[model samples]
Target: NLSVVVIDEAHHYVGSLGASFQGLLWRLERLARHYHARPVIIAASGTIANPREHLQTLTNQAFVVVDDSGASQSERTILFWDCTRDPKTPPSTQAAYLTRHLIRMRRSVVVFSNTRAQAEYVAMAGSDRSHRILPYRSGYSAEMRRRVEHELRSGSIRGVSATSALELGVDIGSLDTVVLNGYPGSISSLWQRLGRAGRTDLDALGIVMVGGDPISRSLLANAAELLERTPEHAIAASDDTDILTRHLLLAAAELPLEETSIEDGPGATAALSDLVNRDLLIKDGTTYRSTKQRPHLGTPFMEREASYEIHFQGTRDHRAVERISIRQALREAHKGAVFLHFGTPFRVQRVDSERREIVCIPETEGHHTQPALFRSLSQGRILEHLEPHPTLGIERIEALVVEQVTGYKEFDQQGRQVAKRKVTSPIISSPAEAVVLTCVDPIYLGIDPEDLFAGLHALEHALAKVLPLLTNGGTSDLASLTLRNGDAPSIVIYYLTKSHPSTMITKVIHNLHEALSLAEHLIAACSCASGCPFCVLDARCDDEVIDKGAALALSRLLGKISVGTALDSSGDEEG
Candidate 1:
């Protein structure tokens, strides 16, 4: 019988994982009810803004929050290193240097990178004969990860470069320093990574190496603000239709789901009806049963996607080296792309889509590959709208997004572009939801069509950097594009994951005034003469079309009009 349940790192119970966990909790609660046993659940987290609400949403139980237990923290020396000041050295190289230096001082360190590929790259760059650094991420096999954890605990290894996979409550012995390769995208995450060090009441050092991204650069300019900002609230879409459908199917397969149970959830009733219509579930009397056998075996609780097996050319019998998701395969395991495994590089020989396999050969050449993508949006259907002002309109719409990888560029070990190659690849398309900001009149703002597009485009990039502040998500969680509809230009901000609900976009539309105010402040606070990555320029976009002055003017106009003020008739805007 389950008496007590403990959930550590409860902050991570968001997104698709959170949705699955919610369904599991419902099942457990029903089981406990049948057994006449009341189980107590304890959810613990480091530092999240909405811990109480987040836990309540996940488990559907009221919680009395315990904010503090009279615990004391060790002194941690936090340093924000502006790597952009010295553009000569890349941030990863600088991080490697810091790792080596810490190891030399007999201080165990953990360098946190944002992505798996970056973790591998940093590990490869930092490792030396004297001190060996290994990469630790989710992509590695279970045995490999355990080996690295054991080595770190026993002091067998000096350092490790890892992604967020290591940021959780994993016991990896003690450490003296933690180097953040870039802004981990949120304040809560920043503190969580810093907490990795100074675990045993010992003074520790934490370094934040500012990256070239706009958000990282903005944080560099306003380090005090970053340090003092409130932690973002954690949000989870438990009522998402797709997620609810999968979980309801699993629930029915576990035990015939009762009609009352189906109606208790937010969208479970409709999902169950759809499943019944599709012949995946059958209604017998008052309960529903799944037709498929062991539905959970085929259903993944995480984001739905196919996995691709990677096979090395010269291996004995050609055993699979690693397995990556299809999304990763398209970006990293495409034909001619350089795939990294355990700090070693391999050039992808072929991507067999039919078999869902990637064939790669060991790459002797020391270079990295970056994919170039072509993305477009179509078939927009408006879901909700808010006309806060006469000149501005905010609408949430569902649309179809198609993305294709057209080519890739190769960069040498020194971080210089070496060559560019074009390749044909399959196109991936999905349905997406977005929040669009429509600018009614560019003439009123005293800008031509060309300048208006540039201004809106710059505003889109700026918004992408700052929206995370309000949404409690990463910069990569949303993407933006500027398009013209008839006479008005609209900025479209959409989620990166297709299964994500419209809650995030809805939040943006509701608090657009705040978002616009933050965007304007971000652009104006920068000291650059024109535009730099620190402000209006996004490194991911075409830099030639970005106009800093026009962006500032448009942002000022929008900010003014959002607060019920009309545009000045004289058209003498001071930006």
Candidate 2:
């Protein structure tokens, strides 16, 4: 019988975190029932905003969340380091400079980078110091990582640079400073990384070095939300049909399920019946057992691995395993593409989609590879519509996006494109739910048809950059699409999660007035003149389709649109 189970870094149990934990938890729950020993589950995370709700959904059990550790919080200072002051220098360079300064000041610091390459770069840049400053990342051996941790604790290592691999509580001792090379994407991770410093009532300092990305620039401009707003809530959709079936089958294999079995929850009855129909299970009286003594059942709860094993030439020992999703593999693992593994470069030789692996060899030629993708909206349907004004309407839509990685470009260290190649691949489809806004009569607002498309497209791009403020998702979790519906210009923003729609994002969309107001504020607050990446132009948008003046006008118009009539209509309809 299981007495206790502890899940650490619990926030990662959802989304991209694959199914091993689900299988383990299912077995433990059954064991507790059979042995009459109820094991206590202690799920731990330092950053989740809604622990109680997230735990209930993850484990299908209620929990009494204990957020109070009784440890008083230490005073902390957060600084936004705007790299725009010196546009010629990269954020990594600035971070390296800041790290060196902190080391000189005798402050124990940990610098966090979003990628392994940046981590190594920072560590290398700061190696000039006399004290021990080292690079720590997942690629390092366990013993090596342990040595670094030990050195840091023993006061031998003065500073360390690392990726998110060190974000969890790894007992590195208290730090005096944290330098973020880029926005950690989510506020949860931002705070968690900062928590590494200032432990045990010691005052600490946190610095965010603005990267080239638009999201980082936006956050740097409006720094208040990063510090004052509540961190995004972590939500899980554990009612996945495939996951449930796998757990039920495992339970049936473990013990015969009877009518009164605890395994027979609300949906378990239907699942078992389906299995019996499929001949995977047999019914004897009221009990169910596996039809095949050794059923070829696979673990379905964990994420499937469609990854490439990068091994050193002439050696069977694998250097690293780059676990990528099917969609990411298609885009990132094409032949001739350059892939960076733990800050080291490798060029793809072949991609065997059937084997679910990419074959790559080391490349001494230093350059970064970026995939050029083409996307089209396959189909769309309006599920609901709220006309906020005579010319403005908000629509809830279900859409399918078809995308393909057609080619890739290589950029040298000087940021100049040097090579380009095209590849043939099957299209990838993503079905999503979207919130679309339509402007029926743009000319009525003194905007031309061409200007309307450009303006709305620009608005769509800008809104997506800031959507993470409303949900537990990052910029990658959502996308924006702009298109023309007959004569009207329309823009759609949608979530990418397949399990369940993010209610937080949808709620913000439902209140279009507030969303538009916030979107306009972001565009207006940008320091760039006549629209730059910081304001209107998104990396996804076509330069031909983005106009800063028109976008600002469109944002202003959207903000002024009166939803009073729609509110009254909705109220009367409810009545």
* Number of clashes recorded per candidate: 0, 5
Q: Point out where model 2 deviates above 4 Å.
A: 15-27, 60-62, 70-73, 100-107, 115-161, 200-202, 211-214, 259-269, 284-286, 292-297, 312-338, 347-371, 375-575
- Per residue, candidate 2 scores C-alpha lDDT tens digits across 267-361 of 56777778899988888998888766545355444544344444434224565554556666666667777765544567778777667677778
Which residues of candidate 1, in runs, are more than 4 Å off?
Answer: 68-72, 211-213, 252-269, 272-298, 314-320, 378-399, 433-440, 445-451, 458-479, 483-489, 495-575
**Pairs in clash, predicted candidate 1:** none
Model 2, total clashes: 5
Reference-based TM-score of each model? 0.80, 0.68
lDDT of 1 by residue, 319-411 (tens): 547988877787788899887777777899988899998889988886778889877777466676566676677766777777788999997
Whole-model Cα lDDT of every candidate shown, in order: 0.78, 0.70
* Every candidate's CA RMSD: 6.6, 7.6
Which residue pairs in candidate 2 have backbone atoms (N, alpha carbon, C) closer than 3 angstroms, thus clashing? Answer: 18-302, 18-303, 19-301, 19-302, 19-303
Residue 62 deviation, candidate 2, in Å? Answer: 4.5
